[model samples]
Target: KDSAEVTIKLKNNRRETVASITETIAPKDVLISKKGSHPTPYDVIHKAADTSNCINIAFLAEGYTETEMEKYINDVKTATDAIFAHEPFLEYKDRFNVIAVKSVSEESGTSVPSKGIWKNTALGSNFDTFHSERYLTTLNLKKVHDWLAGTPYEHIIILVNTDVYGGGGILNYYNLSSTGHKSFKPVIVHEFGHSFAGLADEYAYDWEEIPMYPLDVEPWEANITTLADFKGKWESLIKKGTPIPTPETKDEKKAKNKVGYFEGAGYRTKGVYRGVQDCRMRTNACKEFCIVCKNALTKLIKFYTGE
Candidate 1:
């Protein structure tokens, strides 16, 4: 992976700054240096009469070529349908504008460093981010924004053309996934949970005990918790007598369906906790968002749509 040396700086409102050279390295920024896609033909897949009141979502192509642009549009339709079939988004379908932007790529697939596979994709997306083989992501945020500069978009969803199971998202950033994967629908929705509603991953891995959430400090995400500020989270929704650090039970009606402070989240086996025994944020097996996630999602939707 041929990466370049780059520097970044942060500043306060008064313009006072702390200067430091952070070694931000990655695969060469191919997408940014590439020529722009002008006369960018697009279709408003879902249109609302009141643009000001509705959320704008654009589906852009990542690893598609000019010949595959039509197919990309169809893929966009599939993604739109997938998200709309679920809760919250389903209930408030009309309050959104879905646009399909045809940004053709020089090559037709993403890079997988572990597999020694690389291609000149539109967004420069690839697998093996942070040495996590399936963790697909693109650091070309500026290029992404540049591509959608003229489009009416408040949210972004970049569909990569691949069958490998990979996708990633960040809050208020973008949702990305592989359209060719079997878990396409669920993966996109799960990543959307991160990008749109600021939801955290409920799943945990004992192998990697990264202190992403300090036990003394509460997480700002709506789903997971550190218990330092438990009252600020979904405390109102928890029924009285429900045990804290809720134990996972064999009873489907009690454990899986109920909202309790289940330990193990944010990639840690301990110190972190999620609001439910199981949820879509936790696993693809649980198709629906848990009560807490749904509530947080609904609040965000209402705030945007004024519903």
Candidate 2:
């Protein structure tokens, strides 16, 4: 195992602060770091996206008591191990390291801090925190940047022990705050798929925000597409009749009904298209990742492990 230290810079209308983040590249086991702050109720870390050396996954954990501490550690281990067990990750076992950070919280609080699969009201709304949550108080991005600068991690994954739902985003970072109601092991894996894998939401519904991706522009995601440049990813996987905009019909009798343009996706409709009407990215069914996602993940693993 090897480690590096880096500094992150955070600036705003008020002032600029720097925090140091340490990254330890590991091949086989999980790497743990000291809690950056006391009474720290949350955890954060980075993962290797497409980088050199062995570090593949990074995480941060937070605990307030011995019992919670033990459970948090064990839960993170299980989630990280399970992630690598799947395709792509399984294919690059030697290079994956899910890094974690342990933070403490006030003993009186009923729930610890960890993000959930989605809609973490406990964390105070969704993206709002990203804008309103004080930089140094919650996540000192400058420090996090410094921490990651020391390692070869290109992608980042964060873990939290509370029972509430956890969530992850793109370069913006993900949150998996705890609900303190049930075991969040499964949610950990699901959310990581989004945070670490660049996985898109597969399910569909309505949202206040209109279409996010431009249908004509085509999507960079391996799984979904606007058919603008399908050749790179799912073009080959699409069945002969698979329409440009995959269908959502479950009835086999309507197999023909399966291949047609459908609406609703990527938090919007009209333009963005998805490979299938439903997938693990969009729902909680635990569906296998679409071929494009699988291959992308596989490539990511190879990029890190050289396996």
TM-score of each: 0.86, 0.62
Could you tell me the TM-score of candidate 2?
0.62
**Pairs with backbone N, CA or C atoms under 3 Å apart (clashes), candidate 1:** none
**Residue 166 CA error for candidate 2 (Å)?**
3.6
lDDT of 2 at 305: 60
lDDT of every predicted structure (CA atoms): 0.85, 0.49
True-structure RMSD, every candidate: 6.8, 9.7
Compare the candidates by TM-score and give the number of the best one.
1
Report the lDDT tens digits of candidate 1 across residue range 1-307.
5677787778542234767576856656555443334636788899876877899998889999999988898999998998888888898888888999887899998999898998898789999999998899899888787778777888899999999999998988999999898899889989999999889999888777777777777787889988887886788878889877788988877765677788999888888889888888999878788888988998999898876
